[model samples]
Target chain A: MRSSVALWAASLLVYLFLYVPLAIVVAYSFNDSRLNAEWVGFTWHWYQVLLHDEDMLQAAANSLLIAFIASTCATVLGTMAGLAMHRYKPKLLPFMVITPVAMPEILLGVSLLLFFIQVLNLTLGMLSVILAHITFCIGFVAIVVKARLAGMDESIFEAARDLGATPWKTFKHVTFPLILPAVVAGFLMSFTLSLDDFVITFFTAGVGVSTLPLQIYSMIKIAVTPEVNAVSTVLMLITLTMIVLAARFAPETLKARS
Target chain B: MATPAFADLLKFRLHKNLTRWLVSGPPFLFLLLFFLAPSLIMVLASFRYPGEFGGLAPLRDANPAVLQGLTLETYRFFFSDVIYAEIFFKSFGMALATTLACLVMAYPLALLIARSPRKHRDLMVLLVILPFASNFLVRVYAWMIILGPQSAFAHAIGSALELFGITPVPLLFSPVAVLIGMIYVHLPFMILPLYTNLEKHDPVLLDAAQDLGANAWRRFWDVTFPLSLPGIFAGSALVFIPVLGMFAIPDILGGTRDMLIGNLIKEQFLGVRDWPFGATLSIMLTLMVLAWAGFSMWLARKWSHSHA
Candidate 1:
């Protein structure tokens, strides 16, 4: 009993340590004052500002667009890769497929940037960002989907095939249904990763194509403002909600506790 | 019902080589061109030097005009540079330290959550993981706001400490800030893995130890800790590798003054336009990660084999 109490208290303090700063940011987002700390009154001034901030809005739109395209592409590619890796006996090759993930972002960012500019002669923009994102996102999707595949009953696929189903039909009818939850989970994870990407996007972004993270970073360089705090708060809440939903609804294979 | 019909269609298609190739060809080709080919290009380009006009023109010593014969000049340059060497060593050291700190911090939290009565564990785990779901940069930025000079918490805490005759500590843009941000960002990575492992542990083992007259410390050391090593390894790898590659936290929290190897690589490619050198560094970094990953993979295989 005593140990449990100590544990709970220590954990609670950790929670406060983790969340207090964020709470302050969220609290100040509604502050009527421009200053980050000072709270003159409770008003949605920054929220209102965000409503009309064209640059921020456009950056947000670009971010969503990039994440959507990139994450979707990554999900499809990753699902296929995962399916092949899990079903086939080519274990060593899949490691190479996922190696891009372990390579440092700067390394990847610079190499991809170099490849694009010097070799491919392509300008950076949504296409470059999406490509960069897919590079990393594919690995994430593959890992998650692969883990899910590992947990699935291998006999099910074999059983489907034994009954006279073709490989494609077996995957579509039997394999695909079992893996759907993991695929969704992987997609969400990829989307969030793409949405939150900065260093890679920063190195690869062209002059005019700004992401939300880049915008937030540049804003920080100028000065920390309540509007950013508001945006950060909103972003945090959305992500938190999604993660909780994922954690709760995730299949046994995808659950962290497993 | 539908399963048999689908299976029949799948078996019918499997008889045709064209359909099999069609099913497998695109993903294989995609990975081959985009992933495998690009990495090969990076490796090849790392060995070549840029020529006049700042372009990747070829060196004259090779059979193919564009391909240069192997040169270790890039590697030599990176190794010979004292600043870069220091940055590389320091980044690894910091990553290791951060990993240890997160493990120490995470152990108690995970134990607490795992030990909690059935009703409370889920809530506690949910709260613990909530912050990790936020944008990684925003969370670090939140730290910046809290630790920065203008922080109300900083001022208040400093004043309160002064009342007790203790000097206020300066925290922002220091290594301390980097450690704080890293631990905060990665604590969940550590906690969840440990919790998963610890949850697998049978309480009966502890009871058996007690029955054998082992003290709690001895039991944990002899039984629990050994069982938990895999989690520790997993958690540490998750935290350390990413932290070594981290550019943002050190950039924002440490104010870009304390440059790590990641920053050095970024500077070369983006700032200084030294593509060959950056590629060399990237190759080195990739090699090191692979080496570490290989070691861990071996360790895991050995452990599992022994257990089996």
Candidate 2:
């Protein structure tokens, strides 16, 4: 009985440690003062300020645009790659896919920046950011979709083939529907990752472009104000919502606890 | 009639080999170009000489007189630079500390969550993931508020310490502050993997060990600890690699006083505008991470094999 109590107490403290900081951010967002030192009565003025800020809005819009385009492309390509690996079991495919993810983000960012400026001579802007995001996002999407495909019944594809369906017909009729949830989940996961990405975007976004994270970073570098807190709260809510939705559409690993 | 012929033609073209290529080829080519090619470029660029203005020298500007513009000068500079060497060591030390701290804090919580009822288990898992959904910068910023001097918590601590005639230690912009930020951000990464591994553990083994008169401590050491080695390895890797390269946390909370390798790399690129040196540092960091990962995996395998 004593041991159980001790365990419960320790776990609760850990959870609080994890959550208290976030709660503080939400709290400070409403603090009437610019200085986040002491709360001087509650007000929604910061939220109002955030709503009116044009640069913040533009950064948010740019982030959404990048996330949407990059995730869609990653999902399509990743799902196709996942299906191919499932069927063929190529030994090198997993290694190739995992390399981008396993590489440190700073390295990936710097290397891409170098490649764009020196080799490709492409300008650092939204297009380069999207391309860099897709490069890493594909690995995550492929991993998720591959896991989904592995768990699925292989005989269903055989059944479709035996019924005189062509290879494409079999995939179109049988495989696509079964893996659609995983694909959606992968897409949402990619979307959230791209939205939250900082290191790579920071490196690749050379000039005249700023995502929400990049903007927040610059803002924080200058000062930690209530306006920044308000923007952060909004960003946190969007990412959390996307993640929860992604988990809903994801396969067994996410749902397994229940 | 035309549609039927087109359908037949499509069927004719879609052979097994062709289908396989069509599915995998695009993603493979995409990764090769964007992922593999960039890394190769960085590696090649690291060998070249820097220009007078910070970035690499133009091809034509490379004096053909000196071994076709390739020199070990940047690498030589990196090794000879004491500040760079110190920053690399400090970053490695901090990463090791963070990994160790995460392992200690995460183990019990993971076991508790794994042992919880089904409905509560899912909620606990959600709690672990909730913090991760927040922007990384915002989360670090939140830490700044809590640790800053004006916060109530800091004031209370100051008052309590004043009663003992001891000075209130400022927490922000110090190594301690950076450590706290690192552990807070990475705790989830450690917990999830550990929970997954612990959740899969068999309760029967514990019961059987108890029935055989083994104490709880012995049972844990002889049974549970051995089984969770894989989780320990995975969680460590997940926390350590990112923490090693983490610049934002130390930059914001540590007040940019201490420079880690991540900050150094950033300084080289954005601060100093020296692309070649930045590429060199990046390559070095990547190699270190790869080596650490390989070593951890090997250790996990060896331990698991020995125990099995």
Candidate 3:
């Protein structure tokens, strides 16, 4: 009984530790004070400031554009990778798909930076950022789709094949319908990932391009205004909504991620 | 008639091969081009020389006698300066510390979540992941406010330290703040794997131990700890490896002396434009991460064997 009490108390503390900072960030967004030091009277001035901030607005536009293109490409290719891994169980494909996701983000960032400058001589910009996002996002989408595929009944595919359906026909009629939710979830996951990505984007984004994360990073480094809090709060809401929607689409995406 | 049947079989075989390629081809080529090729370039980059201006020295040269700028200069430089090695050691130590801190905090939370009713487990886990899914820099910035000199918590901590006769250290730009940020960012990684592993453990075993007169502590130390080895390692690796490569935390929260391997590598590439040195440092970091993983797996196996 004593041990159990200790466990509950300790666990609650941990949970509080996880949440208190985020809650503080959200709470301060509405604080009227310019400083983040203490709570003041409530106001929407900071968010209004955010609306008028040209740099922040431009960064947001760039982030969404990059995420949209990258996640779409990642979804299509990742679905194919997932389907292939589930069906054929290819030996090398899984390794190649997952390693980029598993390795430290900086490794991928550095390697791609080297490749961009040295090999392709490609200028670092939005295109480079989109390309980098796609490479990492593909693995995340593939994992989700693969997990969804694994949870399914394999005999259904076999029965369709036995009933004289071509592989393409079976995939069109049955497989696509079953995995659509997961594919959607995968897309959303990748979208959030691409939007939230920083380190990789930091390396690949040349002086001309600025994503929301990059902008936020600069803001945090330079100052601690309530405008940073306002932006963080907005980003948090978008991520929260995306995750909740993704969870509703394919619940297992959350579980399989661990 | 026989010839037509044979032709039909051949057509079917060709169609199946086409289907196989169509299903797997795009992702295969894409990963090969984008992922595999870039990683290979980095490996080659480590062997090249830094260009005079900051990027790689040109690989091709008109004069063949110039050695083409390929040499062991970066690796030699890394060795000649003990500072680089000390940074690596310091980073490793920080990673290790962060992982241990996460494990200690995560264990109780994971255990509680695992023991909860099944319907509540998902919500509990979601709660853990929500803050994590929020912007990473935002999470670090949150700490900047909490640990800033003007904040109440910082004042409290400063006064508390002064009461102990120690100088009131600056809270935001210190190693302590960096560790706090690391722990805050990485605690979920430790919890999730542990929860997944702990949830799988059979409850009957615990009951069996209780019936056999093993107290709760003994049951946990011997049975639970040994059985949860895989989860511990999983959580540890997830925490330790990322923390090892982390630059942003230290960059935002650390002082002058807190330069880890990550900061060093970042400086090499971005600050100094030394691409080869950056690649070399990355390769060394990779090797170290792999070594840590391998050593843990070996230790886990040894631990389980002894218990058995």
Candidate 4:
């Protein structure tokens, strides 16, 4: 009994350590003062201020637009790749798919930036950011969908083919529907990843473009204001909502754990 | 009639192969062009000299008359410089510290969660992932506010310490603060894998060990720890590599004093505008990460085999 209580207490402390900082962010978002030193009375002024900040709004919009387009493309391409891996059992496919994820983000960012500017000669902006995001996001989407495909029953495909259905028709009618939840989950996960990405986006952002993270980074460099906290709270809310929705769509993803 | 059916089957097989190619072709080419090609370019550029200003230019710009145009000056400079070596060592030290700290904290929490009821276990896992879904920078910034000297929490702690005649230790802009941030950011990564591994642990084995007269500690040491080695390997990798490459935490919380390899790489590219040197640093970091990953995989495999 004593040991169980000790274990319970330790776990509680760990959870508190994990959550207190986030609580601070949410709590301070409503602080009426500009300085983060001491809380004055509570107010919604920072959220109002956040709404009016044109550059922050634009950065947020740019992030959303990039995430939407990049994740959509990553999903389509990754789904196909995942399907191929499941059906054909390609030899080099896993290595190619997993490397980007395992590689450090800074290296991936710098390498892509070099390739774009020197080799491809593309200017850095939304397009470059989107393309860079898609490269990494594809790996994640492919992994998620591949896990889903691996768990799926293979006999369904055989059954479809045993009927009058052609290969394409079988995939379209049977395989696609069964895996649609996983595909949607992968898309949401990719979207959230692209949205939250900073290190890679920072390197490839070049001169003009700014995501919410870049904007927050610059703001925090100067000072920690309530406005930054407000923006952070909003970003956190959006991220959590998307993840929860993704989990709802694909229960199997949560089951895999690793 | 037999020949026609055989031909039809052959046609169908051909169609299947074509469809497979069509499905997998785009992503394969996409990774090859953007992911694989960029890494290759980084490797090539690392050997070349920097441009007139700072960054690396195209190889075509090199004059044919210059025999030793491509040089190992950047790499030699990296080796000769004491600061570069120190930064690499310090980065590794911090990463090691963070991994150990995460493990110490994560093991108990994971065991507790694993032992919990089913619904509670799921909820705990969800809680762990929720913070990760939030913006990474924002979460780090939250640390800044909490640890700031002027904040209420900090002030309260300081005053409480003052009552005991102990001076408050400044946390912001210190290595201690950087470690805190690193551990906080990475704790979830450690916990998730450990929880996953621990959740699958069989209670029957523990009961049998107890029935065989083994104490709680012995049961955990003999059975639980061995079973969870894979999680330890995975969680260590997940925590270590990212912490080694992390710049944002040290940049925001540690201020200018705590410089690591990640910051050095960032400075070379963004701050100093030396792309070749930056690429060299990136290549070096990549090699270290790959080596660590390979070593861990081998260790895990060997351990599992021995135990089996």
Could you say which candidate leads in DockQ?
3
Q: What's model 3's TM-score?
A: 0.97
Question: Which lDDT values do the candidates have, in the order given?
Answer: 0.78, 0.86, 0.90, 0.88
Ranking by DockQ: 3, 4, 2, 1
lDDT minimum window of 10 residues, candidate 4 chain A: A249-258
Tens digits of per-residue lDDT, candidate 4, B1-308, equal 89999999999999988998898889899989989899999998888888777777546645765323467888998899898888889999999999999999999999998999887888888878788877999888988998898788788888999999998897688898899999998998899899999989989998899899999889889999999999999999999999988888999999686998899999988888888899999988988898889999999999989988
Instruction: Name the DockQ score for candidate 3.
Output: 0.73
Model 4 misplaced regions, further than 4 Å: A1-3, A255-258, B61-69, B156-169
In model 2, residue pairs whose N, Cα or C atoms come closer than 3 Å (at least 3 residues apart or on different chains), thus clashing, are none
Ranking 1 against 4 by TM-score, winner: 4
In the order shown, the candidates' DockQ scores are: 0.49, 0.61, 0.73, 0.71
lDDT of 1 by residue, B49-89 (tens): 85444436565655565646567778888878787778888
For model 3, how does the per-residue alpha-carbon lDDT over B39-116 read when each residue is reduced to its tens digit?
988888899988878888878889765445677888998899988889999999999999999999999999888888
TM-score of chain A of each: 0.92, 0.95, 0.96, 0.96
Worst 10 residues of 1 chain B by lDDT: B50-59
lDDT (Cα, 0-100) at B39 in candidate 3? 90
lDDT of 3 by residue, A102-143 (tens): 788888888888898788899899989999999999898898
**Cα shift from native, residue A248, model 2 (Å):** 1.7
Which of the two candidates, 3 or 4, achieves a greater lDDT against the reference?
3
Off by over 4 Å in 3: A1-3, B1-5, B63-69, B300-308
| Model 4 chain B worst lDDT run, 10 consecutive residues | B61-70
Chain A of candidate 1 compared with the true chain A, TM-score: 0.92
